[model samples]
Target chain A: MNQVIETLLQHRSIRRFTDQSLDREQVETIVKSAQAASTSSFIQAYSIIGVTDQEKKDKLAELAGNQAYVAANGHFFVFCADLHRHKIVGDLESADVEDSIESTEKFMVALIDAALAAQNSAIAAESMGLGICYIGGIRNDLEAVKEVLKTPEHVIPLFGMAVGYPDQETDLKPRLPLEHIYMENEYQQDQSLFKKQLQDYNKTTSEYYEERTGGKRADTWTGQMAKMLGRKSRLYMKEFVENQKLNKK
Target chain B: MNQVIETLLQHRSIRRFTDQSLDREQVETIVKSAQAASTSSFIQAYSIIGVTDQEKKDKLAELAGNQAYVAANGHFFVFCADLHRHKIVGDLESADVEDSIESTEKFMVALIDAALAAQNSAIAAESMGLGICYIGGIRNDLEAVKEVLKTPEHVIPLFGMAVGYPDQETDLKPRLPLEHIYMENEYQQDQSLFKKQLQDYNKTTSEYYEERTGGKRADTWTGQMAKMLGRKSRLYMKEFVENQKLNKK
Candidate 1:
């Protein structure tokens, strides 16, 4: 009902952006807003890299599935699920924390921490009248991202975000109904209810694609998900996380 | 600069709550605002379980490292990183999606999706003059949670949230300096810069604890991290992820 809630509820991902650049103060405030988000145990296990150089942005754009918005946006940031700082903190305290930091739970902590901060950044940017899109496509090639960003081990680039003045507005994408997404205190194994919800949702999605893509591609939600999930996507992410030496004792 | 950004920047985790309960309409509005957050590829791989029953809340409180707030908050929600709906969606389309749904990337997608939604929910709660605290302590024992919540396979209880009108106001926890957390174009392997920033921050944190605890406990950020990360915490999380049949081909 308030402006903040209104800003959040009217959210949309913007991929295309005008050529206007974000001032330093705006980016600083945005990152500050991100820092204010909740972090597990106050660990604050995340880092963000602002990519402004055109050459580097081009390389990053290519690495992230050629998302031109990575370079074209007013600002681009790669949010890193980082524990390397903890390592330094341990070293400063003369404690060996490599094994403890490498646990899968710790890794999940960092990953979730990065995501919470990013969502705050996204909302903050939007509140400032900026358009933004998340580029999970960065995972399309993690090795290149590591190299391009010189990201050290114990630090993984989870995703990138592009922010700028809007070049276009997009129709809000439909989501699964609230009943389907919100359960009671216990998980409801309602196969019939779930099936019924998706059938109607798929119909809405089919029309959404038909309208958006000019009938070139009109498929149900299940149809699209099946096509996507039928084959292996991002199969290398396990190896990527493993290579970070996170899943070790 | 704006009210929304100001609200975000001033956020603090509220663990103590007054004996106030959220109205049904408020809960409905909060969940609706959560549903408005961005999802990856429209999968919306997340679910919110509202827990208002005191018995279940007490059990969840015990399970989540005895965080009394889990039971005392105005409203509690267990945010699940769920792919179970996608499974139903698959069955509706009669598409084999097990392999695709179980990949590490998809798992991360779900995890990030849940966090984004939870953050939105937190902001929405705050905008309505509510208070919130995230309970990652839920991961302290996921099996108990799954049993309590009847969570099925492919659905992980990612985290919980306690929302209420604040019973107590706590100081905002300090974060690492922007220079330490933000890099330009590439990851900065500047150990010297990180050390400098952390030393100052550690001093600030030590004073904060000293002041907060009436001089009973005075520890630096590095000191806390060293003590916490010196041993394996949540050692069973790897097996938990493994048990979900994710992160495998």
Candidate 2:
């Protein structure tokens, strides 16, 4: 395998970082690489806000479910699904953008754009021998996050990312078998087959957690899913989307 | 810069593909790299359906706005934002997953997860000296796409990707200036600054289209935006989401 594929397959989410800061040029290259990702119709409906201020980082870390890595990383960036730039482009040209910007399809496009770019950034950071983690906890307090980042309407803070030298090593987490996630021509509703696979995966995951947490958190993947998806959390996302006026009729 | 960064920076969408098919090992390696991508809370809310059947590919190409590449590529994979597997997991455990699976946050998570994995897959394919392109036109007819793939409810067909050897070469598309896409700390409403930069970019883009299309299509970025975003298109996405019973209250 080539270096790129090796780097990709060896990926691990690093939550702790070393004290050394990233060089400005390294951060710039990361952003440049992110900008190179593909976009729908080349609209480029996303933006990255790098957070270097200690105070802001601390507040952000607190708002993002108290993730210390957000504050401790050599660099942090909040990727925003933005249509504000499109609005500006439309305004400058006196073109009608209201219909498109408010449509659900446009919203999905922006989300996909931000995500593709973020993945590119992650890969680029890893290629440079930097550890990185994506912070989805930013959605825990969307309103507070908006205020913290001073993000305006037509934009939503999709996710935050922390990049730096690794302070701790982590094992590559196991995933479901290829057959479970891949299908041939049509979707398969093999309930028995999948349930059997899940039971096995659950046992493997239980052992992983047992070893990782020193027997403190020993639960199967199903157990973890029950705890997380048992009840609705982050329900405020609907309100946030409504507040953005993106729910086109 | 390294080969990885150079490959990322040189990314170009390849629509025309040679008749060379991918080896079985190469396809498996690409999927393995995709599974290595980080998932939100480790939910792994995604699935890939590799469509190598010509009859199925032709149907999908027709559904995806008749994009010839969809049928002509050496391989095609429909990356689905899937929650069906989670729902099945919940069913097996008898967990209260109804609320969570139907929420907007969960929907966003699945979409982001699928996009991240798709990007990793794209990068891995490129590393193997293969070309790929994302097909957002999948959304143009989601119901037909769902039927084509036999995808179940709680699983949305987010996007499709075509991968293969390059039959035609294309230039690296230009993007806006760094200052326009990258902000520091807070959101910037620099309308005047961005407008000036966009005007310059539009000129470059106009020339690109003029030279590439043999003067058949010559327009600025703003001109393209006006034509695309000036009217409401793909509004059925909301209906599609609702049809999946994901419109949580």
Candidate 3:
């Protein structure tokens, strides 16, 4: 396998990081690489905030489910789906950007653009010998995050990422088999074979967690998902998105 | 800058690819790298369909808004926001996976997961001297793509990617200014400054396109967005997503 392919295949989220600060040049390079990712329609409706202040990090850590690793990471970036820039474009051109910006499709473009750019940033950081973890817990308190970050209307925080040198090595988490996902020319409804493959993967995941977490065997993929569903993790997201002036076409 | 960073920074969407086939080992490597991407709660709610069959490619090209490049590209992968695996898991465990799988939150997770994995694949492919272009037009006829790809319910085609050696060298596409995106902590809403910067970028983009396309003169960023917004894109995404059993309790 190619080196890049090998590196990607062996990727594991690093929650623990060494106390090493990334150089400014390195950060700039990663951000530049991020900016280079393809944006839908070239709108580039995304922004990233680099969080360096320890106090603010502490506050953000609290907001994000008390993830200590977020506080200790060398660099933290909050990725936002931003339509504020287009609003500026409208202001300059004296054109009504409101008609276009207030639709669900526009909001989705921004969200997907943010995700694509962040994924590029992650890949760029990994290539530079940095370990990274995404903090979806940022959505835990969307309102508080908005206030803390002072996000303007039309800009919503989608997620956070922690980047730094790895403190420990980890195993690659296994995934479902390709057959479970790779379809031919139509949507297939074959469930029996897919179930068998997933059962084997569940066993693999359960055993891995058991060995790694030192007997703290978390639920299999199915059980964890069941628990997650009941958690209503994104209950606030809809209202938050609506409040941000999205989905208001 | 690191070599990988340089490569990433210099990335351009190469829609026109040479008539070369990717080896099986190369395909395996790219897919493995994709599998290594981060998944929300490790549910890994995404998958890719690799299309090498010529007839299938022709049909896909037609379905994806008649993009001839797709049929001629070396490799085409359709990324899907998939929850079907979890449904199968639920059935085996006799768990209420339907409840878990049927939510906007789950849909978002699946979409993000699919996008992140696809980004990884793109980066890995780029590092290996291949070029890629994302085909967002796949959503033009989402139902047709689902049917053509044999996608089961709960698996929406998010986007398609065409990859191969570049048949032509394209210049890098310009993005909005860094200040427009890389905010400090809060979103900066200085409309005047943003407009000035974007106007400058518009000029830069115009120049870049002029040079790259030999005076085929694409519209400025704002103009393009205005034209795009005027069009009726994503016509059936809402109903399609609903039909996939998402966004429901």
Candidate 4:
């Protein structure tokens, strides 16, 4: 594999970082890399907010479940699924894009546009020898995020990212087996085969955790997912999104 | 900038491909790079379908509005927003994850997961001197996609990508201005400023099109957006997603 693929495979979410922060040029390269990602029909329906204010960064850290890395990283960026500009475009052009912007298809486009751009930024940062972690915890309090970021309606901060030089190295987190994630043509829905694969992965993940924690913890991926998803958290997201006038077709 | 960042910034959708197909090793590396992407809560709520069968590729090419490249790329990958495996996980652990899997948050997770992975695969392929194009036209008809791909519940084909050796190289499309797309600490909700930036970008895009097409198409981005989003398309997507037992909350 080439250096690019090697860099991608080396990815690990860095939860802790050194005091070194990103420079303006580095931030420019990262954001420029993000701009190069594909958009749906060139709709360009996403916006990224780089949190530079110390107060806002601290508040966002608190909002993101007290993740200090969020505030103290090299740089923090809030990637938003924004359709507000499309509304402005409609207004400027005197075109009725209200129903289209409100449509679920467009909502998905915004989310995807944001995600593609974010991954580009993440890769760009990593290529520059920086570490990065995605802070989904930002969604813990969207209302607070809106207040802190002054996000208007039709714009939602989906996630934040912390980028910096690594303070520590982490063992690679084992991913789901290739067969489990990739299929040929049709989805391999054979439940028997699927169950066996997950069972095997559970063992691999359990072993990984055990080895990493020195036998303090060994849990299955399924168990972790079940615990995380079974419990009600972020239940307000749906209502929040709809109330923000997005994804409510 | 390093090669990785350079590869990312040079991205342009390659619609025409040489007859050279991707080998198994290349496909494995691409998919492996994809799996290395970050997943929320370790849910890994996504999967990639590598369309290898000639028959299925032809059908998909037809389904994707007869995009010939979809049928004849080095490889075609359909990035799916999959929570079916989570359902399986729930069943194995007997965890009540039905509501969680159905929530819009989970839907967003699946979509973002798929996109991050897709972009990784795109970069991986491009780094290897291959070119790629995302085929969102796959959503032109989801029911047909389900039938053709045999996708199950809680599994949606979000987008398709065609990767192969390039038969052509297109110029980089102009993106939204940095000031418009990137803000500091807060969303810059300045309509006048936003309009001016877009209007400026519109000129850039218009000149780009003019240079590329010899004035055959000198359209503004806002005009194109107004034309595309002003009209209704894919209205069935809302009901289709709900009917697929996803994002029903």
Candidate 5:
């Protein structure tokens, strides 16, 4: 593998940062890379918010379940799935696009566009020896987040990325085996085989946690998924999405 | 900019490819890079399907509106948002994750996960001097795609990617100006300024199209967006997603 592949493979979320911060040059590189990601049907339906204000960052941190890194990173950027620009375009061009813009298809396009750009930015930062972490905790309260960010309708703050010099290093977390995740032409849906693969993955995950936490925690992947998924989470997402005038169709 | 960032910024979709096929080693490296992307809450809620059967590829190409690249690429990959494994885990572990697995939040997580991984794989392919294009055309008929691929419930085929050597070169498409897409601490919702920026972008886009198509086509970004959004396309997407047992909460 080349340096680019190596950079991608070595990625890990950095929660703690040093005093050093990212300069405007680094930010430019990252965002430029983001813009270059392919958009569906050439619809550039996304935006980035650079949060330099300490007050706003602190509010965001509290709103993201008190993730300190959200406020303390070298630079924090919020990636938003935006269709308000398209709405303006429709009005300016005298085109009737209300139905399309409100359709779930457009919503998916925005979400995918935002995600592709954010991933590119993350890789760009990693290549430059900077550490970055995506802050999904912002979704904890989208209403308050919208209020704090002063965003208008048709723009959802999907996630945030905190970039900086790392003060802590994390081991690479094990992923599902390639057999389980990668299919050959057809999806291998045999229940017995799938169960066995997950069972094997459970051992790997439990050992990973055990090693990471020095036996303080020995958790299996399924056990963790069960606990996290059994309980409700972010149930307000659909309602919030609709109220924001997005994905209403 | 570094080589990695340069690879990203210099990206353009390649519609045609040479006969050279991606060997297993290259596929391994690319998939490994993809597996390293950060997943939401470590759910790893995504999967990759490699289609090598010519019959399946031809069917996909036809299903994807006869995009020849879909059938003629060095390699084809389908990135799927998978919650089936999570459900299986729930069953195996006897965990009550039914509601959570079907939640919009989990659906978003799976989509984001797949997108992040696909972008990484794209970059990895580009770094190796291969041209890759994301085929959103697959969404035109998700049912047929699932039939050809034999995927089970709780798995949505989000997008297809065609990777191969470049048979043709294209110019970098101009994106929205940084001023328009990038904001300060809060969203710049000022419609007047936004409109002006978009108008400026319109000129850039028109000039680009004119230069590319020998002045036969001078399409403004807003014009294209207006025209595309004015039509009702993919009206079956929401229902298809629901029937696929994804995001049905």
Candidate 6:
């Protein structure tokens, strides 16, 4: 395997971080790397809030499911799907702008752009000897997050991330078998082979979770998935998204 | 600026590629970098279909708005939002699985995951001295793509990308001003300030595009957007998504 391939294959979500802080130069590098990612038609429909204020970090930690790691992380970033820029451009050109910039395609483009940029930043960070973890709980209270961040209309917070040096070494979490994901040209409905692979992976996951939790095995992948599928995390997302002037379609 | 940062800042869409082919190791490294991107909940709800066959590439080129570069490119990759794996996993565990896996959240996760992975692969390719371009026209004939790829149910083809050594050098495309994107804690809806930035950027972009196309100044940012906003481009996406068993909610 190539060196980069080996490094990527060993990826793990790092939650525990040393107290070391990222300097301005490092932050600029990561952000520049993120801005380099491809955007749909060069619209660049996304934004990042670099959070370093201790008070704000404490507030954000409370907002994001009370995750202490987030408050203490050296470099925290909140990624947003933004369309306000276009709206502003429209106004400047004397173009008639929609009151709300929500359409299926537009929303999809913004969300995808944010995710792509964030992923690039993550990869660049890792390449520069940094550790990182994504915080999806930022959406737990969409309204509160908006108010806290003072986000304008036509933009919605998608996710948050913490970056810093590792405080502890952790094992890479195993992924689903290749066959489960990589299909031929079209989708194959062959479940028999897929099931076998999942079963093997579940056993591996069960043992790992058991060891981590020290005697508690939280069911297998199936059980956990079942529990998760029914749970409503972004219950207010529809209304919230609309309030942000998105997804009007 | 760091050399990597400079590379990223100067990124331009490379629609032209040389005849040089990528080695297996290079392909594998890009794929691995893609797999390493942060997936929502580690579901990894995406896959890449590597299209090396000329016949398939030619057909795909036609399907994607007859983009000549796609067929001529050294390597073509189709990134998909995939949930077929979970269906198989459910079968193996004897878990009650829904026939359709469409939900707004699931669809969002898959789309975001696909974009994230693809972005990582793009950056990795750049790091290894390759140029790339993303083709969103794959959605033009979604059903045709599915049929050609033999894609099973519950998988949506999102985008295609052409990657290889650049046959011609291109300058970086300018972006929207920073003030338009980087928001503070909350979103600021200051319209005047945003308009000013857009006006400046529009002038910059007008020159850039005019030079690239060798045409008298065509559409500015606002003009281009006005033209695109209402243009119906195969946006039966809602129905298409629902058909894939996604966005049920």
Error of 4 at B83 (Å): 0.4
* Best model per DockQ: 4
Give the alpha carbon lDDT tens digit for every residue of B91-124 in model 5: 8889888888877778888888999999999999
TM for every model, in the order presented, reads: 0.97, 0.97, 0.93, 0.99, 0.99, 0.90
Clashes of each: 0, 0, 8, 0, 0, 20
CAPRI rating of model 5: high
Cα distance off (Å), candidate 6, residue A198: 2.5
lDDT of 5 by residue, A1-249 (tens): 688888999999999999787898988888999999999999999999999999999999999999999999899999999999988988988998888888777888899999999999999998898999999999999999999889988899999999999999789999889878888899995889989999999999999999989999999999999899988798788888888787767
Q: Ranking under lDDT, best-scoring first?
A: 4, 5, 2, 1, 3, 6
Worst lDDT window (10 residues) for model 4 chain B? B186-195
Report the CAPRI category for model 4: high
> Which regions of candidate 3 deviate over 4 angstroms?
A94-99, A214-219, B97-100, B213-218
Which regions of candidate 5 deviate over 4 angstroms? none
lDDT of 2 at B190: 72
Candidate 2 collision pairs:
none
List candidate 4 stretches off by more than 4 Å.
none
lDDT tens readout by residue for model 1, A9-101: 889999899999999998998899899999998999999999998998999888877878998999999999999888887778899898778
Point to the candidate with the largest lDDT.
4
Candidate 6 is graded, for docking, as acceptable
Better of 1 and 5 by TM-score: 5
Q: Mind giving the per-residue lDDT tens digits that candidate 1 earns over B13-79?
A: 9999998999998888888888888888778889999997799999999988889999998999999
Model 2 lDDT on a 0 to 1 scale: 0.89
TM-score of 6: 0.90
Q: Each candidate's DockQ score against the native complex?
A: 0.80, 0.78, 0.54, 0.88, 0.83, 0.42
Model 2 chain B: weakest 10-residue lDDT segment is B240-249
Instruction: Give one digit per residue, the lDDT tens place, for model 2 in B124-178.
Output: 9998889999999989989888888889899888888999999998998888778
